[model samples]
Structures are given as structure tokens and as C-alpha cells.
Target: MNNSNKKRWFKKWWGILLIILCPYLLFLVILQSNLDKKKKIIFLALFGSFILFIFLITALEPSTEEKIAKEKKKQEQLKKLEQEKAATLEQETKINELENQKRKMNLEKEVKLKAETEKQIDNEIKQSSSEILLIVSNDDKLFRQDFKLMTNYLADNYSYDSILEAKKIAVNNINKSQYSIEKLKNIKCNLACNNLNEVKAVFIKLYILRIDMLKELIKFADASYGIENIATIPEEKIFRRKVIEYTEYQNKIISFFENIKAERETHE
Candidate 1:
């Protein structure tokens, strides 16, 4: 054929073939139509048949297989992209769930820790109250002992001015009177005047002295007890010094009473 005739032939027929086959091939690819072939040779032969059909009907042009391959590759790439997107979404969801669970656990732990701490504090407060009550009771007993001893000394030496002076000092020092003071005063007046009315008045005064002595002694003892308790683990030297100080104070007070008792005995 002449080149012009061939060119015309190629242009008209090839253009027609492309118009007919392109849509059909694109539809097959779009629908993902699969043709079963048992062997590689069979697959190639099927592809060659489409090429031959196009060649016979029109002048040689681009084959349908290349377009189909490109479409298939594009579809595969899209499928891969969809799979990756789905996987990423799943991972993000799992991560968010894990984070929420971690936050919940941490919150629960914090709540539990707070509750435990409050319980410990409450127990400590109760323990401290109990200790204070015990210490107060001990102070009451000591006050009673001191009041009884001083009263007995006075009763035996009522004529002595020193005995009366001691009573005046005790009354001045005491701030309030309770049961012990009333008893001590009654005993004192009975020893002094031998009158029933005076004896009754003495009882009231003793009661007042008892209450006053208890109040003052508790205040002092509480302060000393707190200081000593906080220093429970103090150095041995510091402990010894505190002990010595307490002993010296006790000895001085005892010596003063002893001198009073001795003077009374000599006069008698």
C-alpha cells in the first residue's frame, strides 16, 4: 500500500478499534473481571488473541493489555492504600483505649492512696487522745498524793507557825478547789479548833485545793511529758541531764519539808 493510503487506513481503523475496545477493556478492568488460565502460556495466548484481533480489524496500535495492566496496577495500589488506612485507624483506636485504661488505673490508685492516708491519720489522732487521757489520770493520782502528804504533816503540827505558813503558800499557789481541797481543809480545821463548823469549812477548803492542785500539776506535767516523749530517741547524755535536773528539784522540795517536820518535832 502507498504511504498516504496506509496512513489513512491506520488513522481511520486504529481510531475506530481504540474507540470500541477501550471502553470494553476499561469495563472489564473496572469490574475486576478475571479470566481463568491454567498456565503462563495460556495467559499469554489469551492476551495475544486480543492483540491479534485488534491488529486484524485495524492497523497496529497500542494494545488493550497495556491499558488493562495499568488499570489493574492502579486498582492494586488503591487497595493497598485502603488496607494501610484501615490498619492505621485500628492502631490509633487501640492506642487511645490503652491510654484511657492507664489513666483510669492511675486515678484509682490515687484515690486508694488518699483513703489509706486518711485512715492512718485518724488512727494516729485516736492514739494520741488515748495517750493524753492516760497521762492526765496519772497526774491526778500524783496531785492527790502530794496534797494528802502535806495535809498530814500540817495536822500533826497545827500549833507551829511554819505549818500555817505552808498552808497559806499552798492556798496562794493553787488556782481552784475541788474534792481533795475540801477534805484537806476539813481535816485542818478539826486539828486546829476542834469545832464541827470549822471542820466543815476545812473540808470545803480542802476540796478547792485538790481541784486547783490537779489543774496546775496537769498543765505542768503535760508540757514536760510532751517534751520527753518527742525526745524518746535522744542521746544518752541529754537523757541523763534531764533526769539529774528532775532529781535535784525533787530533793530540794523534800529537804524543805524535812526541815519543817524536824523543827516541829523539836518544839514538841
Candidate 2:
């Protein structure tokens, strides 16, 4: 083929393949051609130079297999990194769940402890209230007995000595009730016990007031030589009022105990 025809043929896809893959066959064909010897030598030299240039470029680049292997290694590294991130995320999630569980358990424990403490305080208050009521009840009995005896004795008594004697005995018996007051006051009352303590203390104070009123009535009688109309006297009126107050306080203590008992039964 002419130079132009050869150039055109080399430009085709198969011609380029033949040049790169079958250069030896192309050389043998050139040597057998009817071309001039000098032209053949020049063409062979050029062809040899072109083959040499192709060899140098091929030697400098990596092979297809090595490129594939390197790409696969890079893909594997990316996959491993993703797996590690997923594992780390899973571990962090587990840690968060454990922390939430721990907090819930601690909160439940605190609630249980608080409820137990409150129940214990309520039980203590109940027991103490019962004891104080019994003490007051006993004191009330003693007061009633002395008051009854004094009233009966004074109904017919006409002398200062007997009236004064009755007053002394009544006053002495009333003073004995003061022991319950001291005992109640000495109790350790916390915020929970304030209501019960306050009511009981008021009841005792009213009882003491009644004692003072009785003493005043006796003093009036002693001054009048036990002949005055006791019903119309100011001291007698004051004494009656005190007795009414004492009775009201007694009712209040009773009601307080009843309410406490009702609450206990409901809880049970």
C-alpha cells in the first residue's frame, strides 16, 4: 500500500490492534514486500522505533490485574471503616440504655425509701398519741373524783375551816394532774406531731384554768364565811365557764383519737 493508504489503514481500529499485538507479523510482511530495499529499511526502522516507544509507555504503567487488585483493596478498607462506625454506634446506644436503666432504678429506690420513712413516722405518732390519751384520761378521772367530793362536802358545810380545807384538798388534787402536762410537754414533737401536741397542750391548759377558777371560788367562800349564795357569785360563774371549757377540750381529745383510729383502719 502507498504511504497514504497505509496511514488510512493504521487509523482503523483493527489496524491499530494489529500494530500493537502483531508487530512481528507486520515486520515479516514488510521484509517480503516488493518495495525498494532502502524504503523497506527506513519503514522497518520507523516501525521498530514506534514499537519501542509503545513498550516504554506500557512498562511505565500498571497492568489491568494490579489496578483491579488495588481498587478492591480500597473498597475493602472503606467497608471495614463503615463496619467499625456501626459497631461504635451500637456500643454507644447500649451504654445510653444502661444509663437510663440505672437512673430509673435509683429513682424507684428513693421513692420506696421515702414511703417507708413516712409510714414509720406515722406509726410512731400513733403510739405516742395513744399513750398521751391514756395519761390524760387517768388525770381526768382523778380530777372528777376530787371535784365531786368537794362539791358534796361543801353542800352542807358552814365553816371557813371546812370550806378552806375542801379548797386545799381540791387544789392539791388538781396540782397532781399537772404531771400529765409536764409529761406531754417533754415529748419530742416533730413537724408531724405538731397538731396532736398542740391540741393536747390546749386541753391541759383548760383543765389548769378550771383549777384556778375553783380556787377563786373557794377564796370567795372563805371570805364570806361559807354563807354567801355561791350560785350568784362572780367566781362561781367563772368556775362554771371553766368547767364548760374543760368538757369541750375533753370532747376534742376524744374526737382526735377517734379520727386517728379511723385513719389507721383505712390504711390497713
Candidate 3:
């Protein structure tokens, strides 16, 4: 405190003196009231002892200012604890919300990826379907027999040399056709599958018919090559069988193309 305040506090000695005497004065009043001498002495003794204890306790006890300071410190500590608890709960709530947001974002990403993959697969399927039809259309013209070219040598005559020459030319043509068929078989569908098990069912049917056409072509080419006597070798029968197989496979290809269109449209 400043010098003036310190002087004023020191001047309160009379107040201290009055507080010390107040308890004794109260005890004396109690002793003087109506009572037997023995009871009065016992009560006086107890009262004196209580007065002594009060003096000792007052001397040892903290000042009023100290009590106020301690109460303020305890209130600050309690407030700090409350603030810490609130922060912890808020932080936990934020963490839970962030985790929930992350899960939702992951779920959305997974769905988007699934949809994109399906779209890519559908595009591949449609392109593969179109390519397959185009390939089949090419084969129709590739295998169409040109009898005029084969029988061109007959204009010269029905002689052994002429017949042999025509047969040799026919064999060469058959060899070329076999090479072409091999090339055709080499064509493959490079398509992304959504469900291979389902797509495979359709492809398998197409593949079976293609295989049949390949087998017939092989047989026809071999029969033509084995022609010992053109009149009796029945090479024309082999050609006719090839034509029938080709026609059947062409029909299946057209049907398959239509089916693919229908299936895609249904999904749309």
C-alpha cells in the first residue's frame, strides 16, 4: 500500500483490542446470570477454555484478503476445467463429423467409378458388335463363287490339257480362299465385358456357328485339292455344303446383331 494507506491500517489497533475483549465480556455476562456456584464454575471454566481456543485460532487463521484470493484461485481452476471439458467434447464432435464426411465421399467415389466402368464396357460391347457384323458381311462377298472365271478355260475345248489347266487354277483359288478363311478366323473381339458369363453365352453361339463355317470351308478346300476326277470327285457338293453353312452363319450373325441392339436399348 501507499504510505498514507499503511498509516491508516496501523491506526486500527483499538479495533483489534475491542475484538480481543468482546469474547471475555460475553463470558462474564454468562457467569453472572442465575446459576448454582458449582454449575457456574464449570460453565466459567468451559467458557475460559473456549475463549483461549478463539484467541489461538484467530492468531493462526489466514487474513480475510487471503481467503478471498484463495476463493478466486479455486473459481479460476474450476472455470479452466469446464473450458477444457467443453473443448474436448467439441473436438470429439468435429472428429466424428469429419469421419462421417470421409465415408460419404468414399461411397460417392465408389459409385461414380462403378458407373464409369460400366459405361466404358457398354461402349466396347457396342463397337465389338458392329465390327462382328461388318466382318460377317465381308465374308458373304469373299466366298461368293465366280463360276464364270472357273469355267473360262472351257471356251478352248474339253481336252485333257484344258481340263487339267482349269482344275489347277481351281486348286489355286481354293488355296487362296483357305488362306482368307484363316485370316478371317484370326479376327477377335477386343471388348470390355460387364459380365463375361452373360456376354459369353451370346459370343459362344456366334463362335460355334463361325467354327462350323470354318470346318465346312476346310472340308471344301480339301475336297477340291483331292479331285482325282473332276466329274466324280463331288467337289460341287462340298461347295454347296459350304454355301449352306455360310448362309446359316450369316443369318445367325444378323440375328445376333439385332439381339445386341435390343439388349442395349433395353438397358437404356
Candidate 4:
């Protein structure tokens, strides 16, 4: 009869009730001789109907324990789903970080590649120019060509139709090759080669070479400026002074080159 308990259609409760009730009713029949048979049958039918009703109610209701178990299973599934979502999010974050790092590295490499390419171009330019000047200085034909051009510009009142012979006469007392414009230009070019100390040496060589080249131009200007003869023109004095100054600079460069070369040879 308890709602919390379960029961089958026919089992121990029904059989026990029949066993005890039947005997009790028989006892009642035997005790009261005046009792009617129809009254006993009615009493028995009422008791059977009440027990059947209780059995049906007990059998049809759902169990509390099974419902609790189902709720627990549903909660566990939700918790597992939440954990899987968290793991997926974490994995995605890690992948994004890796991709960012790869992108950064690629960008750095691109910038570095561009910088190196520019540096290589500048180096090639200097190297090639150095080679050209060295060839111009060493080739006698090229040197003579520049010399003739410079001399032709020298419109001195007196004809230097044989300027080569006259030039040989003027420089006979000194080393002509060392003080020549071509040799000084070559020294300036040699600064680009792998033969000297870096910045300071290149600056010094270039400065001195400029003087060497400039003095020769000054000589042509002095000769061309006035129609007067060499004896009367004060320009002759200025030209000779510049020539001396240029000669001194040439000596300085030659000295540096010779000293450095010797030092390198000694160390080797």
C-alpha cells in the first residue's frame, strides 16, 4: 500500500493475503451459525478489489532512483563537452601564436635581403671604378692621350709644338712617373682596393690626388690666360709653385703606400 514501494501483478503480498483472509473468513463463518453465505462472499470480494487497486498503483509509477541516475549522466555529458571546448580554444590560441612568429621571421628576412642587395651593388660600383682607373693609369697609350689633351690646352705665347720634348726637359731633375697626373689618379683608385687602412687612408689619398690633378689644370690655365710671353707673365711663377706643391703630395702618398706594403710583407 506504500507509494514508495514497488509491486508485481501477483506475488507474495497477494498470496499471503489470500492465505490469511480465507481462514479468517472461514472461522467467522463457522463461529456465527446465523451468518448468511451471500454476506461472506460480499466481504471477500471487497477485500480482493482493494488489494488489486493498490498493486496496480505500485506497478505503474516510475522509480526515483532511475530518474536521479539519468540526471547525473546528463550532467557528466555537459561537463565533458565544456572541457572539450576549452581544450579546442587553447589549441587554437597556440596555433595563432606560431603563425605570428613565422610571419615576423619572414618579414625580417625580406628586409635583411634588401639591405644586403643594396650593399653588394655599392661595393661592385666602387670595385669596378677602381679597376678602370688602374687600367687607365698603367696603359701608356691612355696616359699619353690624356697628357696630349692637357698640353693642347696650354696656349702659351711661345709654341710648345714639341711639348713632349719640353716636358721631358722640365721633369728631368725629378721622378716624372711618380708626380704624373695619371699615377696620382691611380693612387686614388688604389684606395678602393684591399691594400690600405680604411677611412683615413682613403680620405688622405683622395685629398692628395685632387691636388695633383688640380695643379695640372692650373698649369694649363696659367699658360692660356694672357697673351704675354713666359718671362713677362707672373702666371708662370704661380704654375711652378703649384707644381712643387703637387709633387710634395705625390711623395706623401707614395710614402704611405710603400710603408704599408712593407709592413704587410713583414707581418706575412
lDDT of 1 by residue, 1-268 (tens): 5743454321466755774766444333323324443444565566668777977777655469977998899999999999999999999999999999999999999999989866654454344323332333344456456555554643553334434444553554354334334333333221223333332343343344444443433333333332433224233234335434544544554554344335434433
Candidate 4 pairs with clashing backbones: none
**Which segments of model 2 are wrong by more than 4 Å?**
1-66, 157-162, 189-191, 198-202, 205-208, 218-233, 257-268
RMSD of each: 22.5, 7.0, 12.4, 13.2
- How many collisions between residues are there in candidate 2? 0
lDDT of 4 by residue, 135-160 (tens): 32353344445445544544443444
Q: Where is model 1 poorest over a 10-residue stretch in terms of lDDT?
A: 187-196
Could you estimate the TM-score for every candidate?
Answer: 0.36, 0.63, 0.50, 0.36
| Candidate 1 wrong stretches, greater than 4 Å | 1-62, 144-268
Q: TM-score for model 1?
A: 0.36
Select the stronger candidate by lDDT from 1 and 3. Answer: 3
In candidate 3, stretches whose alpha carbon ends up further than 4 angstroms from where it belongs are 1-56, 144-191, 194-254, 261-268
What would the per-residue lDDT of candidate 3 be over residues 1-268, giving only the tens digit for each residue? 5753454321367644654666465455555456788888888889889878988999889899999999999999999999999999999999999999999999999999999877877766665555444554454344344324435543453344554565555555555545444444444444464343354444445445444544443444455454555444555466456546656765766676577657656645
Weakest lDDT window of 10 consecutive positions for candidate 2: 1-10
Please rank every candidate by TM-score, starting with the best.
2, 3, 4, 1
Each model's C-alpha lDDT?
0.49, 0.71, 0.59, 0.52
Better of 3 and 4 by lDDT: 3
lDDT of 2 by residue, 167-233 (tens): 7876686567566677777766564576666756765676677666676656666555645455555
